[model samples]
Target: MREDFLHYVWQQQYFDKQNLLTETGELLTVLHPGFHNTDAGPDFLNARLQLGEVEWNGAVEIHLRASDWHRHQHQTDARYDQVILHVVLTADQPVLRTDGTPIPTLALAGRIPLEMLHTYQQLQTAPPATLPCAPFLTKIPEITRLSMVDRALLERMERKSATVQLLHQQLDNDWEATAWHVLAAGFGFRKNTEPLARLAKALPLRILRRHRHNLLQTEALLFGQAGFLSAANEKAEDIADEYVQMLRAEYEFLRHKYDLENTGLKEHEWNFLRMRPANFPTARLAQLAALLHARPLLFDALLSAQNVAVLEQFFSNESSVYWRTHYRPGRAGKVPALGRSSMHLLITNVVVPLRVAYARSVGQTEQVEAALQLLTELPAEKNHVLALYEGLPFTHRTAADSQGLLMLATAYCQPLRCVECAIGSRILRHNSALK
Candidate 1:
């Protein structure tokens, strides 16, 4: 019933071909259906067809109703003038070109198979459900489902790596800088990623490189650039804290040295309300400072560490004495170092993408596969979106599978794009409901 369904039927030749006729009863012969166009003009282009005793080559346009030609005002447009045939589900009215030449109409109302419509209607008109195909998932074969999920996981990683590629380009093709920015964003977790990335961009890797050997100076640059060195960020009682005062003094000196007076983030750019204290941006920044201070080259470390265990050990010690004792500067509390799950997330989000981007840049195709392989070794991410499939037939359980399910939830299920999904297509095909 939908225009896209009609477009699908037309493109796939789903309707009968025995003794074709345009509504006026001129014998029709479709030598070629033409290429489907997605742009602003005709539905199909460069079509070769035979109408009555004459042969013609032009475009073919499809509409659910012939009256839609007028509804769309294609009669006045020169773009539609090239249309030699108007294929519609029903011929409600006559149509003409810009110069008043009659374009032939082909009505496919009775020609299309009924069962196909029944299957398509189910996919297109499913009720408000998170996964509309959930009811039919049991009908989809295991191999088909697993293959699609694997494809989705690769697609999700590719999408995530695209952001890495853009960062690499913006950082003048420096993989080290790109890795730093990616790790900074990953450290932000979910809420403060943009601000953290902005902070990293403001304080470039070159500047961080000079101070990496000295943890205090590195902390000074990160905290100062994050706008935490300002008095507004300090509590009244904490003003006399010797450690906080020392960092502030050192940041002021560094700020003046690097001429970075106006290039720092505001506190409002970070999100602190409602989230746990451990997940605070302040705690995350301290963790990031520790990583940069210990690891001189982040991208090189990623290249050298192929396995997940190596990467796990590398991210384990991301805390200094000050960070272990305080959640934020001038605040007296115990702060936990990055946990196993947090480290897994950083490796999945930052390390994997960094590997893939670097591999593609250097034309090392196998390294990309090795990078994606890391996901399979890590534990699956546990979240509400994935929790929905707990009792279902989806048996694949790894970070790859979790990522795939998340991708499938957003990119296919949420959009109700089942007709194009592999599982949905197989269900329809196996039931003799589709071509």
Candidate 2:
């Protein structure tokens, strides 16, 4: 059996406690199980145990076999010196302190109920599956499932917030600049997120703000940094269109004026394979340029947004005039404007994460709550992961719900961490008593 299963049993006090004895035949009573230590010192800390008539307080260590203490070289390490009890699945050998004093040992070989072992075996030995607990998922109480979903959503937000915090640190705590970088990455979507992030880093918010009032110049800076304006090199003779010529000429002037460098970001870094035409890098960059031109203080505006509707309205801007009929520099077609679904994606992934990060950095508790509330207002994201939970007892009505399902699928279900999941815990708790 895995040590984690033993940990679960010991932490929950699931074994028979009617009569306990040490290997030396002394009566043993556990007054306290102690705090389970996740770090290196011991398995549990500050345990209070009553041995015979005397009470002892110290750390407790667990092992599969009593001989493992020596196998792990705990005899040579002072960290195990304070261990008051050696709890093992099998006491195959005696253990002693660094001073050669014999330590009390307790074997849980038969103390754990056989039914519980069967339940654990089912969870651990299940065949390869996406949702290991799927067979018993519907049996869990609705309230328990909902609570786990809520917890999963919060975990996702906390993880995203940590990423934002890292970005904020990288940007030297410039919230607006960090927001711009994150928003650009979001605009890139999955196919081109890294390239878009590189584009934002190469063209700083300060440079973009300098030309924000002039949309053409702002577009020129973005396109130039993204290596789009360099298309004039190979297709010099074909740059007959005035708009392309203007952007090329303007980018050259701005590139020289601001002493800007592309920082090795090439046009080829963008991926267009199998992506929708509207999601092409060219179209996305143009949309981003339009947003940048329109909103110089986009992060500030998002922070002041009292609700999701206001945030939606804030993002409701079409691409620049030149992009109305063009998906790329030379290609011209009726490309769709940024749709509602894409807008929701940006709000959920970019704006909310940014808001949460900024709120946490500035210690504004209410803003963090408001930012999370925005997820509840937006519709749930549609993806294969969320699709796995369709027709299940739970409902996916908002981004929060979708995020929670995504977390469950990736973190818990995919890893077969049934013992750690609330639903899985309940299923095992109920079924452990059945044969």
Instruction: Give the alpha carbon lDDT tens digit for every residue of 167-272 in model 1.
Output: 8998898888888899989998988988998998889999999998988888989988998888776777458778778888989998899899788998778899
Q: Where does the lowest 10-residue lDDT sum fall in candidate 1?
A: 426-435
Name the best candidate (by lDDT). Answer: 1
Clashing pairs in 1: none
Q: How many steric overlaps does candidate 2 have?
A: 0
Instruction: Rate residue 365 of model 1 by lDDT.
Output: 89
TM-score for each of the candidates: 0.89, 0.91
Residues 1-435, model 2: lDDT tens digits: 678777767766778777799999989999999999989988999999999999999999999999999999998889999999999999999998899988999999888888778867777776754456667777889998999988887788778889999999999988888888899899988789989988888888898898899989988888888888885343643276678889988988989888885462776777989877798999998888888878878888988887778877787778887788888786777778888898888888888888888888889978877888988898888887777788778778998899888988888877777667888778767765431
